[model samples]
Target: MASTETVKVKVEFGGGTELLLAPPQDKRHSLTLPRKDAAGTETNVTFLIEYIRKNLITEREELFVDGDSVRPGILVLINNSDWELEGEGDYVLQDGDEVVFISTLHGG
Candidate 1:
Protein backbone atom coordinates (compact mmCIF):
# COMPACT_ATOMS: atom_id res chain seq x y z
CA MET A 1 0.00 0.00 0.00
CA ALA A 2 1.26 3.45 -0.84
CA SER A 3 1.78 5.81 2.03
CA THR A 4 -1.07 8.27 2.49
CA GLU A 5 1.44 11.10 2.23
CA THR A 6 1.38 11.29 -1.56
CA VAL A 7 -2.33 11.39 -2.28
CA LYS A 8 -4.31 14.53 -2.85
CA VAL A 9 -7.90 15.00 -3.95
CA LYS A 10 -9.72 18.03 -5.34
CA VAL A 11 -13.51 18.12 -5.23
CA GLU A 12 -15.93 20.45 -6.96
CA PHE A 13 -19.56 20.57 -5.97
CA GLY A 14 -22.61 22.04 -7.64
CA GLY A 15 -22.71 25.73 -8.51
CA GLY A 16 -18.97 25.92 -9.01
CA THR A 17 -18.07 24.88 -5.49
CA GLU A 18 -14.64 23.42 -4.87
CA LEU A 19 -12.38 22.05 -2.14
CA LEU A 20 -8.86 20.71 -1.92
CA LEU A 21 -8.27 17.58 0.16
CA ALA A 22 -4.98 16.59 1.69
CA PRO A 23 -4.09 13.07 2.67
CA PRO A 24 -4.34 12.11 6.31
CA GLN A 25 -1.16 12.79 8.25
CA ASP A 26 -0.29 9.13 8.73
CA LYS A 27 -1.53 7.54 5.51
CA ARG A 28 -0.75 7.98 1.85
CA HIS A 29 -3.42 8.17 -0.80
CA SER A 30 -6.20 7.37 1.67
CA LEU A 31 -9.27 9.51 2.22
CA THR A 32 -12.13 9.47 4.69
CA LEU A 33 -15.20 11.61 4.20
CA PRO A 34 -17.93 12.52 6.64
CA ARG A 35 -21.57 12.98 5.87
CA LYS A 36 -24.58 14.24 7.79
CA ASP A 37 -28.10 13.66 6.57
CA ALA A 38 -31.25 15.65 7.24
CA ALA A 39 -31.68 13.91 10.60
CA GLY A 40 -28.47 15.43 11.96
CA THR A 41 -26.37 12.29 11.97
CA GLU A 42 -22.89 11.67 10.67
CA THR A 43 -21.30 8.80 8.77
CA ASN A 44 -17.71 8.32 7.78
CA VAL A 45 -16.74 6.71 4.51
CA THR A 46 -13.26 5.88 3.31
CA PHE A 47 -12.21 5.81 -0.33
CA LEU A 48 -9.15 6.54 -2.40
CA ILE A 49 -9.55 8.22 -5.74
CA GLU A 50 -6.24 6.78 -6.88
CA TYR A 51 -7.86 3.37 -6.61
CA ILE A 52 -10.55 4.41 -9.05
CA ARG A 53 -9.44 2.48 -12.08
CA LYS A 54 -11.00 0.75 -15.02
CA ASN A 55 -11.53 -2.44 -13.03
CA LEU A 56 -12.91 -0.92 -9.83
CA ILE A 57 -15.16 1.52 -11.66
CA THR A 58 -16.35 -0.48 -14.61
CA GLU A 59 -18.63 1.00 -17.24
CA ARG A 60 -21.51 -0.22 -15.12
CA GLU A 61 -20.67 1.26 -11.74
CA GLU A 62 -23.24 3.79 -10.67
CA LEU A 63 -22.21 7.45 -10.55
CA PHE A 64 -23.05 9.16 -7.29
CA VAL A 65 -22.42 12.61 -5.90
CA ASP A 66 -18.86 13.01 -4.58
CA GLY A 67 -18.30 9.44 -5.62
CA ASP A 68 -19.87 8.58 -2.30
CA SER A 69 -21.06 5.08 -1.47
CA VAL A 70 -23.91 6.05 0.84
CA ARG A 71 -25.49 8.93 -1.03
CA PRO A 72 -26.40 8.07 -4.59
CA GLY A 73 -29.00 10.76 -4.86
CA ILE A 74 -26.69 13.17 -6.66
CA LEU A 75 -25.00 12.79 -10.04
CA VAL A 76 -21.41 13.26 -11.15
CA LEU A 77 -20.22 15.23 -14.13
CA ILE A 78 -17.32 14.01 -16.22
CA ASN A 79 -15.47 16.47 -18.44
CA ASN A 80 -18.37 18.86 -18.01
CA SER A 81 -20.78 16.21 -19.23
CA ASP A 82 -23.31 14.17 -17.35
CA TRP A 83 -22.24 10.56 -16.93
CA GLU A 84 -25.76 9.19 -17.19
CA LEU A 85 -26.32 10.78 -20.59
CA GLU A 86 -22.82 10.11 -21.83
CA GLY A 87 -21.40 7.13 -19.96
CA GLU A 88 -21.48 6.06 -16.36
CA GLY A 89 -18.46 4.63 -14.57
CA ASP A 90 -17.11 3.88 -18.04
CA TYR A 91 -15.67 7.38 -17.89
CA VAL A 92 -12.09 6.83 -16.93
CA LEU A 93 -10.28 9.49 -14.95
CA GLN A 94 -6.95 10.84 -16.01
CA ASP A 95 -4.32 12.60 -13.95
CA GLY A 96 -5.05 16.24 -13.13
CA ASP A 97 -8.59 15.77 -14.37
CA GLU A 98 -11.69 17.62 -13.27
CA VAL A 99 -14.94 16.04 -12.08
CA VAL A 100 -17.96 17.66 -10.54
CA PHE A 101 -20.85 16.34 -8.44
CA ILE A 102 -24.21 18.03 -8.30
CA SER A 103 -27.44 17.61 -6.38
CA THR A 104 -30.73 16.32 -7.78
CA LEU A 105 -34.30 17.06 -6.79
CA HIS A 106 -37.76 16.93 -8.27
CA GLY A 107 -39.74 20.11 -8.54
CA GLY A 108 -42.20 21.88 -10.78
Candidate 2:
Protein backbone atom coordinates (compact mmCIF):
# COMPACT_ATOMS: atom_id res chain seq x y z
CA MET A 1 0.00 0.00 0.00
CA ALA A 2 1.00 3.59 -0.53
CA SER A 3 2.50 5.17 2.56
CA THR A 4 1.40 8.70 3.36
CA GLU A 5 2.70 9.16 6.83
CA THR A 6 5.72 11.09 7.96
CA VAL A 7 8.87 9.12 8.69
CA LYS A 8 11.49 10.10 11.18
CA VAL A 9 14.97 8.97 10.31
CA LYS A 10 18.60 9.51 11.08
CA VAL A 11 20.80 10.55 8.19
CA GLU A 12 24.55 10.35 8.48
CA PHE A 13 27.42 11.41 6.27
CA GLY A 14 30.96 10.12 6.27
CA GLY A 15 33.97 9.66 4.03
CA GLY A 16 33.91 13.39 3.39
CA THR A 17 30.19 13.56 2.74
CA GLU A 18 29.77 16.12 5.51
CA LEU A 19 31.81 18.62 3.55
CA LEU A 20 28.82 19.23 1.34
CA LEU A 21 26.61 20.30 4.20
CA ALA A 22 26.61 23.43 6.26
CA PRO A 23 28.94 23.95 9.21
CA PRO A 24 29.89 22.90 11.65
CA GLN A 25 29.74 19.97 9.26
CA ASP A 26 27.67 17.79 11.47
CA LYS A 27 27.33 14.27 10.09
CA ARG A 28 24.17 13.21 11.80
CA HIS A 29 20.71 14.50 11.01
CA SER A 30 17.38 13.71 12.51
CA LEU A 31 14.80 14.38 9.84
CA THR A 32 11.09 14.07 9.48
CA LEU A 33 10.07 13.74 5.88
CA PRO A 34 6.78 12.90 4.32
CA ARG A 35 6.21 9.28 3.50
CA LYS A 36 4.49 10.41 0.34
CA ASP A 37 5.68 13.29 -1.77
CA ALA A 38 3.77 15.78 -3.92
CA ALA A 39 2.90 13.02 -6.38
CA GLY A 40 1.65 10.84 -3.54
CA THR A 41 4.16 8.08 -4.10
CA GLU A 42 5.88 6.44 -1.16
CA THR A 43 9.01 8.24 -0.02
CA ASN A 44 12.02 6.10 -0.65
CA VAL A 45 15.79 6.52 -0.91
CA THR A 46 15.43 8.20 -4.30
CA PHE A 47 13.05 10.77 -2.88
CA LEU A 48 15.22 11.26 0.19
CA ILE A 49 18.25 12.05 -1.96
CA GLU A 50 16.37 14.83 -3.71
CA TYR A 51 14.97 16.12 -0.49
CA ILE A 52 18.42 16.23 1.10
CA ARG A 53 19.98 17.88 -1.90
CA LYS A 54 17.36 20.59 -1.89
CA ASN A 55 17.06 21.09 1.82
CA LEU A 56 20.18 19.98 3.63
CA ILE A 57 23.05 20.31 1.21
CA THR A 58 24.55 23.77 1.16
CA GLU A 59 26.74 23.55 -1.93
CA ARG A 60 28.62 21.37 -4.40
CA GLU A 61 25.53 19.40 -5.31
CA GLU A 62 27.38 17.78 -8.17
CA LEU A 63 29.88 16.24 -5.81
CA PHE A 64 27.28 14.75 -3.50
CA VAL A 65 24.81 13.57 -6.07
CA ASP A 66 24.47 12.82 -9.75
CA GLY A 67 21.24 12.52 -11.64
CA ASP A 68 18.64 10.99 -9.30
CA SER A 69 21.14 9.02 -7.26
CA VAL A 70 24.43 9.40 -5.45
CA ARG A 71 27.45 9.96 -7.59
CA PRO A 72 29.63 7.00 -8.50
CA GLY A 73 31.81 5.79 -5.59
CA ILE A 74 29.31 6.89 -2.99
CA LEU A 75 28.08 4.12 -0.74
CA VAL A 76 24.66 4.19 0.85
CA LEU A 77 23.47 2.07 3.69
CA ILE A 78 20.06 1.74 5.28
CA ASN A 79 19.78 0.40 8.77
CA ASN A 80 23.30 -0.98 8.39
CA SER A 81 22.39 -2.93 5.25
CA ASP A 82 23.65 -2.05 1.80
CA TRP A 83 21.14 -0.01 -0.17
CA GLU A 84 21.43 -2.33 -3.14
CA LEU A 85 20.15 -5.15 -1.00
CA GLU A 86 17.20 -3.04 0.04
CA GLY A 87 16.17 -2.12 -3.51
CA GLU A 88 18.49 0.85 -3.76
CA GLY A 89 16.41 3.99 -4.24
CA ASP A 90 13.17 2.06 -4.22
CA TYR A 91 13.41 0.97 -0.61
CA VAL A 92 10.65 2.43 1.51
CA LEU A 93 11.91 4.26 4.56
CA GLN A 94 10.73 3.21 7.96
CA ASP A 95 10.42 5.32 11.06
CA GLY A 96 13.71 5.48 12.96
CA ASP A 97 15.62 4.04 10.06
CA GLU A 98 19.22 5.10 9.82
CA VAL A 99 20.57 6.09 6.44
CA VAL A 100 24.24 6.63 5.90
CA PHE A 101 26.29 8.00 3.02
CA ILE A 102 29.98 7.38 2.58
CA SER A 103 32.04 8.62 -0.31
CA THR A 104 34.68 6.20 -1.41
CA LEU A 105 36.20 8.69 -3.79
CA HIS A 106 37.89 10.62 -1.03
CA GLY A 107 41.61 10.28 -0.64
CA GLY A 108 43.26 10.07 2.73
Q: What TM-score would every model get versus the actual structure? A: 0.36, 0.93
Best by TM-score: 2
Query: Which runs in model 2 stand beyond 4 Å of their true positions?
Result: 1-4
Model 2 lDDT, full chain set: 0.92
Q: Against the unseen true structure, what C-alpha lDDT does each candidate score?
A: 0.37, 0.92
Q: List model 1 lDDT by residue over 24-82, tens digit each.
A: 21111322222332344332112323233221333323332245331455566655676
lDDT of 2 by residue, 2-108 (tens): 33478888999999999999888899999989978899898899999999899889999999889999999999999999999999999998888999999989565
Model 2 steric clash total:
0
* lDDT (Cα) of model 1: 0.37
- Which residue window of length 10 is worst by lDDT in model 1? 16-25
TM-score of 1: 0.36
lDDT of 2 at 53: 96
Candidate 2 deviates by what RMSD? 2.9
